[model samples]
Target: MTHDSTGLRRLLLVVADGVRHDVLADEMDAGRTPALAALRARGSFHAVTSSFPSGTGPAYVPFLMGRHPARVGLPGLRWYDRARSLSWAPAQARSYAGIDIWHVDGDVHADVPTLLDLARPSLAGMSMLGRGAKHGRIGRSVAWMLRAAPSHFRGDLLGWRRVEQQATGAFLSRFAAVRPKVSVLAITSPDKFAHAYGSDSAPVRAAIGDLDAAVAQAQAIAVRDGWRDALHVWVVGDHGHAPVSQHDDLHGWLEAEGLRVLAHPRLHVRDPDVALMVGGNAMAHLYLSPGERTRRWWPTHAARWGATLDALLARPSVDLVATASSATTVEVRHATRGAAVVQRRESPTGPRWSYLTTTGDPLELGDSLHDLDAGTAWEATSATPYPDALVQLSWLATAPRAGDLIVSASPDWDLRARFEPVSHVSTHGALLRPQMLVPLLVDLPVTRPPHRTADVVPSALDLLGISCTTDFDGRSFLRGTPVSAAG
Candidate 1:
């Protein structure tokens, strides 16, 4: 951790997976995390919103690439990439028992480079709960495992405690020894435990306590042996989790309703049946396969798409259904709940959007048709509890590989594929607040109020005194600093 004034500065970023802002606040207030509380006092703490779909992939993509998943070429946790002939899904990683060590189609490099790439010589990523090993030396991971061998041997072989230990080691190695410009340490216990046992369970709280202890250790190492005052630390949650009181077999329902449910995109299909390509626990991508139905009959048979959307909206478990009408327009409908149409429009300042409501609750876009400012769009979505909901979904709905129909499940229920083993007790992947709201705390003096997860990256670049060379959907919260982008 010894360095001269000429080398790259170091930053220690800790991502506490699945821990909600409110939950973290409660923990800090209860004095369960004294060290974390102290850190917050020395810095800024704001409730940041996660990306739309609100799943790990979408959330992580923003933080890493400083862009929305759709813009970065990563759509969701599960999506079919036609160019690569690959599909990102849990079934692909099921054999690993929630550990996907290898990169999948969704794990490709983005159009905009990530913090890992931009911050050269950076040590980033963690391996556990299917998070691919992007970078960082395997030796440190092994050392952490060895250090926690006694606890793993005694009991809790694959528990959050082990994850905390590994995180501690990762922080120590990166901040104290390697001293990279940007070191990302992810603690994935709260998310995993919350899925097994509800988000508000005692076990989840205990996991937070363990994370707090780990944070304490990491901070002590940074101050005692690492970069000390030079190290800028930011702690955040990928996405929040909500208790799922009910499980919806959207795939089963589609099958029972006489629709074919193909888990992934099939290169060739002879049948005329409509199919469903499911994504996360709360969203499904419905599309007609490449066949006579898609090629010839589909153009004249617009009713098929309408009927499918209608049927999906009729489902008691569904909350919202959306699709792209054009390159810049999206229509979002909720059964009897509400409906709205949003379109991207050119503005004197920049590219903005217009929103109009047809009927029902408005779902979040409000009750009138009006133009919206690009800079204030995130705040609008946050107010609606639909973080970047309009733009991101619009990209997916109109994408070349996008499904004909896109659906979001109700908060109380989680949408799942027919073949999934079981539904989680606590889950994410929706526009609702419980899943969208996350914690963002940084030691640096930010210029603006942080609102979105993608803001973290530009802020990081600001902290490193580096200029961004990519077009990021997110802007820096730090004032006067501009992040550049390569066309």
Candidate 2:
């Protein structure tokens, strides 16, 4: 990574997966995490919303490439392309469960450039989305471990912590030799523990302590390896987790309703009319059709799925359902709360968006919102229960990889109940606040931290005086200036 002329010599980012804002905040407030507390003392730390789906795959887009999850067209970790599956190809559906994880780098938009590309001589230690990193890639072997342990409290927790240790160890041993300009280390124990235990459980809290140890080690190593004063560190989370107890058998419920479902472990169904894929158990994608294998253009025909939608919302675990109303609009429905529609349009100022409620407030934003430009829309929904839902949902509603009918599970419940060896006690991958809210710990002080996680990369690039041609949805808020929207 060639930096023109900057005071900072290297940019280091750490992602502690599945960390909740309140939990970490309490950790820092209680003086338990000396390293994080020290970072906060030197820098600024604030709660920010992760992108939609809140799963590791789509959620990583923002931090890696400075693009919204929807803009890249891969909405979730699992997706079924009706256009590809319904035709002779019949191979577009996948769950990226174990060995298939490598396909993610290939599926993202080819034109988009990741930090590994823009910031060369970079290292992705367990940062899974290391498409362009040349030094070394860690954590890909974690997939092999998952096949053995299957991601549970018994063995995978230790394995994930080992991955964290190995990543940090690599930084310690290799930094002096390689001297990578940009390095991103992913600490995965918190996420794994959160999945096995509750988000606020004792085990997950201990995982946070372990993260502190990792941070302390990284700090000492960075200073020792010629980055004492010329290093910028940003510690963040890919997504947050919410506690879960009840499981909604979304796929089973479809099969019981006389629809053929395509599920994992068993990838095919004869003459399938429904394809159900899940992300973090809290969010589900249901592509429903009458044996036509259709996923596109379902938003305009929401009436055809009225009975199914009613039954799903009536299901105890379901929260809200979203569908593409059009290319730039989304139709949303809650079980008992109400219904709403989010729309996008062109305006004199710039492209504007709107959220109007024909019935009750499904999103509970209170009143109907009129035309709002991008910045206002972001500011308006930044604090809602569904953070950034206005623009996030609009972009997701039209995403090619998204479902015709998307479901977000209610609190304390998840959508996957069967066909899995392991069950999660706490999960993310929903539009809810706890799942979407993540902590952004960065050294840069700003009047307002960009509420979106996608802003991190562009902001980092701006810090190092590096420029890229990719049009990022995330804006850089650094050097006391806003990242020009059109730039």
TM-scores of all models?
0.83, 0.91
Error at 84, model 1, angstroms:
4.8
lDDT per residue (tens digit) for residues 1-487 in model 2: 1222454457778887888988998898999899888878866888888888888877888999888876875788677776563222234575555555666777777788888888878887766577888787665655534533444324456655665666567655665567677888777778877887777877778888877886787667766875655566788888989989898888888889988788665565687777788978799888776245445576455667778888998988888899886788888889777889898997675577889998889988988899987678888887788988887888887887778888888999998887544568898888999999998887646645677888898888877678687777777767464323112
Query: Cα RMSD (Å) per model?
Result: 5.6, 3.9
> How well is each residue in 1-487 modelled by candidate 1, as lDDT tens digits?
2322454556767788888888888888898888778777766788888776677655677777777766655556665443434444432211112222234223544345778777766765452222222346332355655654454334442453665665656556655666667767777667767776777777778878866776677667767864565666678888888888788876667668776555543313335354454544666666555333222222334555667767778888788877777767777888776778777877676667667776754465556545666466665676775776656665566655555667777878888733443347788877777887899877545667887888778877776777877867677887563322100
Error of 1 at 227 (Å): 2.2
Count clashing residue pairs per candidate. Answer: 3, 0
Question: lDDT of all predictions, in order shown?
Answer: 0.64, 0.76
Off by more than 4 A, model 2: 1-8, 85-91, 141-155, 290-295, 299-304, 347-350, 479-487
- lDDT score at residue 51, model 1, on the 0-100 scale: 73
Using lDDT, give the best candidate's number: 2
Model 1 worst lDDT run, 10 consecutive residues: 91-100
